[model samples]
Each structure stands twice: as structure tokens, then as C-alpha cells.
Target chain A: MACVDDKGQLTASARKLLETIENNALTPEEIAKEAALPLFKVRSSMRDMKSMGFVTEEENGAYQMNPEASKLLKK
Target chain B: MSEETMSQVNSLPRIGSKAPNFEATTTHGTLQLSDYEGSWVILFSHPADFTPVCTSEFISFQNIYPKLREMNTELLGLSVDSVSSHIAWVRNVKEKFGVEIEFPIIADLNKEVAEKYGMIMPEESSTETSRAVFIIDGQRTVRAIIYYPLSTGRNMDEILRVITALQATDEHNIATPADWKKGDKVIVPPANTAEMAEERVNDDSVECIDWYYCQKEI
Candidate 1:
């Protein structure tokens, strides 16, 4: 696998998911269902988003959208 | 399909006009044609990076890379494959075909670049892109364009001939005739009147077949 760029930005797939989840908090399963992504893709995207500071996961297993991703969605 | 349908298919990124600027993360990271402002760009799209037909085409392009570079042109390839897939394909081409590709190929996983360039046709292949080539001048204006069917491979000789023809026209302000090849006689546009035609024959350098037909050795 290729290493991420040093900027900590999301890869293309991760970016697409962040774009999808900007409006509201969605669990990995919900993200996979709504975005037409597979389960593994949702997990990978969530991990990348969390690392890039674009998402935060709750103790109850829900993912919350971060402000950066929210701003991108508004645009 | 009909010519009208093909023209409609290629209408998104208008041919014989400026190619649209597209920024995408390729196998070599973020790239854009605007970055190479002072040189020519040959941006081509393949069905998929690792497929058999595309592999041969890529190797052919790579073999011609040195010549293209000598003419101050750069090549950029594209497909709707992941960057890792592109990397693997490049390695495969080098190892098996004995040619090294020294250009960046856009991954275009989301089909953004392909859509922007009209490279993807759902009617052609729902999951793959069509074979597309756009030759842009130093000013980022498209000079020539060619599209090949999925099964038929592109002619590298024809591509080189077109570049030579375009460059010659730009330098000499002359137009080439149909099926023009390098070092072959070039067509001189007929002068409008009999007086100009009479003067053209006496010019000595140009061969006049008739009053309207004049050929010049390039």
C-alpha cells in the first residue's frame, strides 16, 4: 500500500466519504449503505478521516463530522 | 455509431479548442497541465491501466517518449484505476516490455478527470474509459484530437506525424494535405485567381500539377 502524503489530507476515497458524512453523524455501516460503499471502504475511510481531523467517533459507535469537512460540504 | 453521435460524445471537452484544466492526484501525486506552460502536452486516456490492450499502448507510448521529449512535449496518461494499480501496471510494463515510463498517469478513481475530459462513455464501457488523446500546444490550446475504439490500438506513427505537421504549420504558416507524412510534399493552398496561379508556377520551388493544385517539398 502507498503511504499517505505528509500533509495528512484524505485520499480520494476517504475524501469522498468525508464529503458524504459532512451533513450529519453516521456510523460506518450507515455510511457504507448511504454512500454505496462497501464495509471495508467505510472502515478505511473512517480511519483516514479520523487521522485527518475531519471526523470524531463517539463512545456509542457513531461518527461525528468535524468542522473542516462541514465547511467543504457547504461549498 | 454515427459521426453525429461521436461528435456529441466528444462535445463536453470541445475539440479544436482549449483543453480544460484539471487537477487530480495521480500516481505521482497532484498534477496539472498548467504546470507545464511552455511545452506541449499529450494527455491520453486508456480503458484501464493494467488491461492487455492498454498495456501494449502504454509501452508503445513509452518507447516513443524520448522522441516526444526531444520535441518539447510531455505525456500524461489517465484511467479510472487506483494509483496503486497504475504503479503496478507501470512496473509490469517496464519488467515485461523493457520500456520505462517516465510520465505521470492520473489515477482518476472517481472518474472526475475522465468526466472532465469526456474520456468516459457509459455507452462504451460502464466501468472503463475509452481511448482518448488530446494534443495541446504550449498555450494550453488543443491542436488535435483522436479517439480509438477499445479494441483498436492507436497509431504512434500517426500521432508523431500530426505533431510534426502542427509544428511545421505553426512555424511556416502553411497547411498540410490529407495523409501528410514527414518529409513528404506539402500542399499549398490554391491562389484565388489566375494571376496568382501563374505567379505560383514561376516560383520554381513549388510543384504545380494544375492551376489549383500546388505541392511543395518540405
Candidate 2:
């Protein structure tokens, strides 16, 4: 997990992906394009990040960075 | 099949071994591995076309294409998809992401290249390739290989960093430390003999934690 730490917090890749999703509600493909990550990676990371409350899935199935992730990114 | 023949067919190229050559159809055109001679190559494989993860990986690879070219390297993507599937997927990616994927993508429908590279891990998926990366030098030797499970995406920054580190080591005969990026101090190869170790003790040019571990500016 290049984007996660031992404490289960977001690191480089996770943080970058979150930043890409900050204001934009995007599909996995869109997120992968925006974040410059592989689509498979974005899907998997989003799953983990979402479960950790770092991101949220909208009714339309797009993803957005949650408030918790924003705070962590700010740091 | 004999054990020896099976091993030869299934085994992946080891570091320092010659990269197996192949000719295949790509989005750009038909290409052979030998065509990339005299340039470094980052040969990678994805699971499928039009899939989310593979799409993102392609986009990311596109983002780094320029940097790789600047380093005298070429990017070649591959999958078990057909040439038509690869073409359609490329079109979709360009139209959707506004990214033009300029690299060639090998359509390994027959799984010939996949078999040679051992890209398909049956435990993960019988039909699809796990994410695999092979870095080959200008001389066509396999320099580095990285593999990720079907679900995980690769770290683009790390990929670039590794290429940089490998090039640096080849040029300067120095090794990188953990999490080492460009401009960071590199580890000097340990002294080979006691006499050289004694000479290394007084070498003021580098910061030595011990005879075997020393750091020096590039």
C-alpha cells in the first residue's frame, strides 16, 4: 500500500487520489485520469479510503473526498 | 511436458537476463521487441480493455510518457484484449479523458507474449494478467520487474523514481537508500577488501555510518 501507513492512514498515492476527488464527484475512470493513477488502483484504494471515511460514494456512484480526508490532507 | 521445458516456457526473465523478444500487433502498429533496441523500455501489462483499473493505469502511463521519453525510454502496454478492443478502448479513453495515449499497446490475444512474460497468474485470474512491469535497458537486458495484484494500482511516482535510481546507479556505480528520490545522498558500495575499508575510513568525501554503509552526494 504505497498510499497507506501502518496506522491505516492515507499516504502519498491515497492523498493524491483524494486531492483529485476533493471537489469533483468522479467515477473510477475519471478519478484515474485526473489523479494519473491506474484505474484498477483507484478502484481498490477508493474502496479502502471510503471504508475509512476518507471518501464518500454518491447516489450516482461517483466519489468525493469526505471531510475527514480533507482535514488529513490539510495536514 | 518435461520439467525443464515447462520451466523454460513458464519462467519469467530474471534480472540481467535477456528480455524475450516478440512481435505483436499494437495500437500504433505491429512492433517487435527488437524495435526498441538502443532505448530503455517500460513494458507493462494490464488485465483487460475498457475496465476501470486498466483505464486509469493507461492514463497514468500517458502522464509519465514525456518524462520517460526524456530519459530515452519507450512505453509499451499490453493485454489479452484484441487489437480492435485495444483500439476502441484507446478511443474511449481519449474522448473521455482528453488524453491521447501515444504509446503502443500490444494486443496479446493469443497469450504468446503473456506466456513468455508469465503475466497471467492462475491463482489470481486465469484469463487476465496481473499488473506487471518490466524495465529493460538499452542493451535489452531485464533490469527490474514489478508485479501487483489485479485489484491494486501501481504508484507512478515510485516507477519514475526507480527508473531514475537505476539510471543513476548504472552511471555512477552507487546505490540508493530507502525512499531515495533524486538529489538525495546515495549509498557508496562497500569497500571490497580490508585495505580498501581502511582507506574508506578516512575518506572525507562521503558520510560514513560504517565501512559497509556510506552516503555521498551525487
Candidate 3:
């Protein structure tokens, strides 16, 4: 998410993160630990995903992929 | 300094230039600059192996080695000394100061790598290299350069700061402010057009001191 190019494609790191998050709702820390990425990376990824309406933050600050994003990304 | 020597000193690779590639004998054996292609490099030089200032700098560099590695940055040290000298110096540092120097030190006895990197200050001592640090990115492009007089030791904090700042800017596509460290708010580039500048101030996502200066957390 942080390295998005001019063409608006997800960066390799972001893709790794997204693929790491499949079907799972998790906090940034959890996602980072699970994905074996840094916490700041997960935070940036979640922020970008949230801005793009691809993810939503729960009351506990955990994030989950939106149905629209899942369907769109499924393509 | 002589005219010829001054010209040699000033001939260093500028920022954004490709790093001069080299393969030389190191404490760890023969190594090449290209071996570190997929990682960031902090290629540095010191005056000699057993000098006081250089010894302190080496200890400090070893202190920050773990942190640098976690950030995918490697440290490369060089001096116009022989490999045996480097090995003895590393052992001496460990035995005397109890801090092991793990990074490979290039034994540039022929001054090939030193001259290529402009580490040899003919003015300082043709036989020794002055303190020089080059930050090279994963693509082998020189990202930043710092030169320090041989008398003064390098600041480990500043070295860490520069690495952190450089990595942060690249990853987030933002610039760092003066005295910026990790977790500090980062500078957002100014808008390119007049309309964007007006909209930028009102965007509210970033705090702006003026239309030209805006900062946001990453």
C-alpha cells in the first residue's frame, strides 16, 4: 500500500500483506506478526486499504477486508 | 593540498550516481559490491586499522549492526590496510574493548577500492583513507554521502538517523523534517499546481504551516 505506483496497483509488500490477511480480521500488530512483516508496514497497508474502501476498522481497531474488495480483488 | 590532490579528493561519486563496483580482499575473504545488490549498503572507510578514533567508530558501528540488519542495511568498512592487519585489529578491539566487530573490513592494500570511492585523501595521508560514508540503495545507486575529517569520530546516532530517514522516505514516499526520527511526522511534498496548493491547505489530512509546507503522520 505504501509503494503504490502511478498505475494504482498494489505494491509487492502490500500484496503480500493482503494475501496474508485472507478471510481473517486482525489488528495491525497481529497482521504484521502473522505476515512476518513490520508493524509500521501493516499500519500503512491498513491505512491505504481503509482509504481505498477495501477494508474497515472494527471497534477494537482490527481490520477486515470489505465484501466489495474481496469480490473486486477476486477478479 | 596540491592541485592534483584536491582534484582527486573532489572526484568522489556524487549522490544518485551508481556506486563504483569493486571486489577486494576483506577480513571475511574476497567480496564484491555486487554481492549486496538486493540490500542497502553503508560503505564506509577509516584512516587505518589501529587508530584511536577509528577503533571507537568501529565499536559503535558494531553496536548498531543488529538494528541496521533488521532494516535490510549492511555495513561495509574499508581502509588501505592488509587483511592480516584488519583481522588483528578486529581481534584487538574485541579483546581490549569487549565489543566484537563483525562486519567485513575490506583490506584495500592496493588502494583500488579506496581511490575509486575517493576515500584516499592525498592531503590527509596518501597511505591511509579518510573517513567517508556512502549510502547505497538496493539497486547499487548511491543514495547519500557523508565525509568527516579523520580527527573526529563518526556519530552512530546520526548514522542511524540517516538510514532511518532514507528508508522511511523511500517506503512512504514522503520526506523527513530536520531532526526527524522514526515515529515523527513526515513532510508531504508541496502540490505541483496552484489549484492543488489551495486544496492542499484545506485538505485537513495534513497539517500545513503554509501552502508550501505540509506534514502528516505515516
Candidate 4:
């Protein structure tokens, strides 16, 4: 599980990936490119975030920030 | 395959490019490039089997096989020869020269792997591949590519030396001087700006001939 803090913030690589992901559902490749991070790093972080319920995978293989996590971020 | 694919495969793959993948029959059975992932591989091609020069090269490569294995590297040979021909040639070498061929040889009857690696030399012999060597690293990147005319054989010691240099350079993040071997001091990357160069010179950990060029022991 990712070390998400009380402020709904992910730590280390998970935090970097969470910051890159947006609500419109971006593919991991696009996120990696936008963040200038390696594809493997993006993919591994995505896997961890998805399992931790901080992110969601869409049917088209793109990722979106979970609505609950998004709400928490706003607070 | 399209013209783009033809151009990509027919041309010699450049160093540092991802090695072109292939699956083919070998003396050991069905083999694929992916099978050797995470291990250094020396993929080489000979003009033909049972020839004197090729026989000597094969013997030399076999002699260094154990050393290469100690370095976590594998040897793979290729030619535009059939499986039965490869088997017969390997058996003949063992019987006549008393050298057991332990490594697998690719049976590239259709020149499949040859075209992918641009091993076939039409000028030398339309049917046979030239003596080509590609040193692929554990990450599947082509580290080095060497070619010798069909008449000339390769130096296995030189190949081993190259692998050592590559591994050392990667591990130490330093460059190897020409003809460099293990335990030799390695060349450090030159500083970028004037301020860094000043700092580099005063750094006692490294010996600098000048502000730019430095040598260090790893």
C-alpha cells in the first residue's frame, strides 16, 4: 500500500504520479511524458495507487484520480 | 513486411538500439531473443560451417565460453545453415578436434535472423553471412557491433575485453581509455562550467592531468 498521509497526499513516487494524473483519464504513457518520468516508474506507481484506492483504471487503459481522493485533495 | 520494415531489418542495427527480437530453431531447440533477457549475450554469425577459418573461430569462442558464463554472459552463433547441417558440423568438430560444442548455434536456413541483423554479405557470398559480432548487454541494448570479412576470423579475447569495459563504464559512470583493461584507472567525465572545473582540480579523490581531464580508481 502507498503511504498516503492524513492530508490525502501520496508520498515519494506515488505522490509524483498522483500529481501527474488528471480527472479526464490520461494513459500511463501520456502521464510519464508529461511528468518527464520513466515509463516503468509511472507504471509501477500506477499499480500501487490503483490497489490503494487512490486511483482508478478506466476501460480504455487510462487512469483517473479517484473521486474520493479528488475530494480529499480539495479539502 | 513493409518497405520501412525492410529497411529497418535489412540495414545493420546501430549500437545502443534495442536488439531486434527473433524466434528460431537452434541446436538446443526453439530459442527466442527474449529468452536471454537480463543476461549479456554475444550474438555472432559465421560465413558457413565446416570451413577452416570458421572452425578456428568456433573453437576460440568455445574456449572462452566458460569465462563468459562466469560473467553472466551467453554465446549464441548463427549462420544460413540448416539444423541438420549445424548438428553435423558440431558433431564433426567434437569427433575430429575433441572440442565439445556446448553453446547453441542458430539454424537460420531462411536467413531470418541474418536479415534482421544484416549479417548476410552479398558481395562476400550471396548465400552466407559475414563474420559479424553483436555484444548485447543485459538490458537488451546493442552495446557493440563488429564485422570481419568472411576470410578474417575474430579475436575472442578482444570481445571479452569489450564486455569488461562496457560493464565497468556502466558501473563506474566513467569512460575507458583505448585498450583499457580491468584494474586500470578510469577516465572521469570533464566538468561543464569554469567553476566546476576549479572544484574538480582541487578534489583530492581524483587525479587530474588538467582541470578538464581526470582519472580515478573505482
Candidate 5:
């Protein structure tokens, strides 16, 4: 799940999850389906997204977007 | 070298001021800034046509064009590329992307318009224009300006946020706070007294963070 980027060596699946969430909100299953990654991998990515402070999961199980996430999609 | 440097330094346009007028051949025809007299203007510059980032940005803008027009705002896209290049790109946008960009895209082949707007920044691009956005009011005064680095694309949401903020400030004579979006709380200017702040928080619909920091729904 780790890889090197121009920015740094980071988690590959996490980066993939960030890419998926950049365009739209998705649950773990939806992220797995869209990314073609495994369920565990998607969960890992979601965890990474949380750690990066790019997304927040609401109590209702819905995910909320942050300003950084919005900016990333635009970029 | 000093004189050349000074001249180059003097060439950049200042933001929050009057946008210089220019005439350029667009997809629709020749366009002048004066023609959009009674409407707000979103004058945006792109790096190039037929590119991925530019394509997505154009499509997104076109998709929201109707909403923008409803706000009495007109869009004017610009790049240093030629008019034919722009036309082909517009056609491709409609045919391939299924989005129509009805707005006129200014073709500044000579970089005249680009230089006038400080769109041609060598630090960002030596051979192309950078992603620059300018929001001009109905009176043709620059209200807000933004620039994106070459590797980064501009945010349509942030663009619209700035426009909405400007409109709100003009309408209500209030100021927007950091990361302000539509329907979010806006800042109320600091009153000299805590009593005034408490009164503001209690009397206003905005959520009060503290006595000094009062926010209201915009």
C-alpha cells in the first residue's frame, strides 16, 4: 500500500482513495467498487483520508467534504 | 538589465482595480469589455485549449453558465492561443464532452490581452498563459482576483463563492469571513463593547462564537 510520489513516498491505496473522493463522496463499498480496489484497501484509504483531514464521516454514515478536498478535485 | 527589469516589473497589472478594456476576436465574434456594461463579468484565463485540465474547467463552467447568467453575470474566457484553436476546442467540447460553451472566448494571439491582465507569467508558464480569474462588477471594477499555478487547476466553486461574497457584501454591506460559502455565517464587524457583541449574538440569526467574534447567516 506504500508508494513513492513526486510529493513523497506515501500510501498507494490512500492516494487512490483520495483521487476517488476528490470527485464525489463515497462509502467504503462504493469507493472499492469505483476504484476497483479491495474492500480492505478502500477502508485503508478512507482511514488515510481521515488522517489527512480531507474528509469527515458524519454520524449518519455520510461523508462530508473539506475545503482541501474540493480544491484537489479542481486541480 | 536594470531598465529592462524595471520595465518588466512595471508591466504587471494590479488587482482590485479597473480591468483594462480590450477588443479581441472570439468564437461569437469581436468582443469588447464595454459591451458587458450592465452585467457582472467573470473574465477567466486558461493555459491552452485541447488540454485535459482546460477541457474539464471549460465543461464545468459551461454546465453552470445558466446559473451564472441568472445572477446577471457574463463569462469571458481567454487564452493566448488563436481563435481557430478556440473554435475547434469549443466544437470538440460540445461533441465529445456533451457540453456547450456559449460564452465568447477571447483569442489573444499576440499576448496583448494576456499581458494586460497579467495572465502571461513566466514563472507559471513561459509559452502559455496561466489560470487567472478576474471578477469584475457591473461598473467594470475588479472586485476579486485569483491565480492558479500551472500544475494546479482553478476551482469553480471558489470562483462562485467569491462572486457570491462580493454580491452579498454589496447588497448587505457586510463582510465575509474565511472559507465563507453560501448560507454560511458571515462576520459582523467588531463593536467597541461586549454588550453590543452579546446583543448582536442574541438579536442576530448568526451563531456567536464569542463576544467579539459574531457570525450571522448570509
Candidate 6:
């Protein structure tokens, strides 16, 4: 049903992580490097975004933006 | 706090009590326990994702999903893993086992659902949930609860049989014998009065081994 919060908002760190995964699936380390954030922050943001159904994990332990997340990005 | 006190605080939902409700992110979508208000729910929790035992259990659950649906039941799986891990595991299971898990799996990283369901047995493992199954009826009341140690896999046939038995008992006011299956004779409730006990002896419709033990055909 309501996949996102009432505000349909993503934190700045979450948005950075989501943008990195929007094109290619990447592990937390890679996302941190690409987003210029620390690895620990990327990891925590990924967990938060994942619970919101924004990103999904690949078989290789890489994270990618789900379709629901893509829609959010477009909006 | 003492172990006993901690356990008492996180005790499992008792049978005949209302199932605790929660909103969780799942593989299918964000869903609440109230979503399946008019159907039976098999809310099960595994220890983790990608583990061998949990993987096999997921496959087994997928195999019986159709059968359960036929009985107006829905399956919802849970683990303390993140949603990303759950998605990865689901894909892996499909590729390796050739069984697609159609049911939604709750990603309980916060352990909200697990704590409410008393799935995490502290004695077993503080971080992971034990193999727990809660069968909630259409009315959202818990009808049965089965818990297995982390090592032992659950029995699908037994789960199905119990659902059948519960349904039959509700429909006919009867009880099921040990190892009972569908189409088998069901036991009648024991008579409480002397006259009813006497009538049970003369009731040809039922087979009575004793006054308290009587069975009738469904």
C-alpha cells in the first residue's frame, strides 16, 4: 500500500545511495566511494532505503534501485 | 533482567488470542497483517536469509503455497534480514530450486515483528528468530502455534493437516485424532451428561469405542 512515508521523502544520504544504484548495482563500499560518503553511512542509508522498498539487493550482494524507487526519482 | 522475566515479556501469542498486527516492508510491497482480514494466514519466521535450512524451508513453503491458497490461506514469511537480502535470497532460491516464492516476505531488520511474535528465542540466539509458525484464522484469532528448534525443518504435511483439522473442528464441533487426515472419521466431543453418554452408546451414526471416545463420519 503506502510504500513511502506521507512526505514521500528520502534523506540526503539515502538519495545519494539511491542515485548510485539507479544505474548500476553496487556494494556499500562502491556506493560510498561514488557518493563521496563514508562506508558506514552508505551501509546505514542502504538499510533504511531498503526497508522503505526503495532498493533491492542483487545475488552478488550489490544494491540496486527498485522500480518503485525509480518512480520516486522521476517525481 | 532475569532470563525468565525477559522471556515472559516476549512470550508468544497464545492460541485463541488475537494476532498482533504490524506494518512491514515485504518482497511484494509494504503490507500490514490486517491486509488479509478475510483469509487464514500462515505467518512464519525463519532465522535468516541465505542460510541452508531457511532456504530449504522457503522452497518447501513455495511448494505448498497453492494447496494453502486452495484452503483460503495466505503465507507470509519473516526474518531479521534486510529487504535487499531477502530479494537476493528469493532470486537465488528461484534459480537453484526452480521454485518461485510468490508469498511476501517481511524484512524485519528492526525486529519489530519478531519481537511482537516472540520469534526471537534469546536462549537459542539473540539475533535470529527460531522456526516459528503462527496460524491465524479468518477472524484474526490465532488457531495454532508450532515452534521448531533452529536446526529442525518444519513439516508441510502436518501444517496442512492441522489447518484441515481446525477447520473441520470449527465446522462440525468435532476433534481430530492423532495423525488424522482429511476424509478420516472425526472424534465427537465427549458427552457431559449421563443421558448423552447413554445416547452415544445407542447412536448408530457414530462409532464409539467408549463413552468419551466417539467418532463420526464427516
Q: Largest TM-score belongs to which candidate?
A: 6
Residue pairs with colliding backbones in model 4 are none
Question: How many clashing pairs per prediction, in order?
Answer: 0, 7, 0, 0, 1, 0
Docking class of 4: incorrect
True contacts kept of each: 0.00, 0.00, 0.00, 0.00, 0.00, 0.11
TM-score for chain A as predicted in candidate 2: 0.85
lDDT at position B162, candidate 2: 91
Each candidate: what lDDT?
A: 0.78, 0.86, 0.84, 0.83, 0.75, 0.85
- Name the regions of candidate 2 deviating beyond 4 angstroms: A1-75, B1-5
What tens-digit string does per-residue lDDT give for candidate 3 at B1-218? 69986797677689988998887777754567876776798999999989899999999999999999898888989998888899999999989999998788898988899888888767778788999999999899999989898899999899999999998889899999999999999999889999999999999899999999999999
lDDT of 2 by residue, B1-218 (tens): 79986886657798899999987877654567876776799999999999998899899999999998889788999999998899899999999999999888899999999889988998899899899999999899999999999999898998999999999999999999999999999999999999999889789998899899999999
Classified by CAPRI criteria, candidate 5 counts as incorrect
Candidates 2 and 5, the one with greater TM-score: 2
lDDT of 1 at B30: 59
TM-scores for all candidates: the values are 0.69, 0.73, 0.72, 0.71, 0.67, 0.73
Provide the TM-score of the second chain in candidate 2: 0.96
* lDDT of candidate 4 at residue B183, scale 0 to 100: 90
**Model 4 per-residue lDDT tens digits across residues B117-190:** 98877777889999999999878899999999998889988999999998888888999888888899899989
* Stretches > 4 Å off in candidate 4: A1-75, B1-6, B9-11
**Model 1: per-residue Cα lDDT over B1-218, one tens digit each:** 89986776666666567778877767655566665566788999999877789988998898898899888787889988888899898988889888788778988989887877778778778778899999988888889888888998999999998999999888876789899888888888788888998899788888888868888876
Please give the lDDT score at residue B10 for candidate 6. 58
Clashes in predicted model 4: 0
CA deviation > 4 Å runs, candidate 1 = A1-75, B1-11, B193-195
Candidate 6's residue-wise lDDT over B1-218, tens digit each?
99986796756689999998887888765677876666799999999999999998889999999899889788999999998999999999989888898888999999999989889899999999999999999889999999999999999999999999999998999999999999999999999999999999899999999999999999
Q: DockQ (Cα-based) per candidate?
A: 0.02, 0.01, 0.02, 0.02, 0.01, 0.07
Best by DockQ: 6
Q: What is the DockQ of candidate 1?
A: 0.02
Per-residue lDDT of A20-52 in model 6, one digit per residue for the tens?
A: 888899987788779975343455456667776
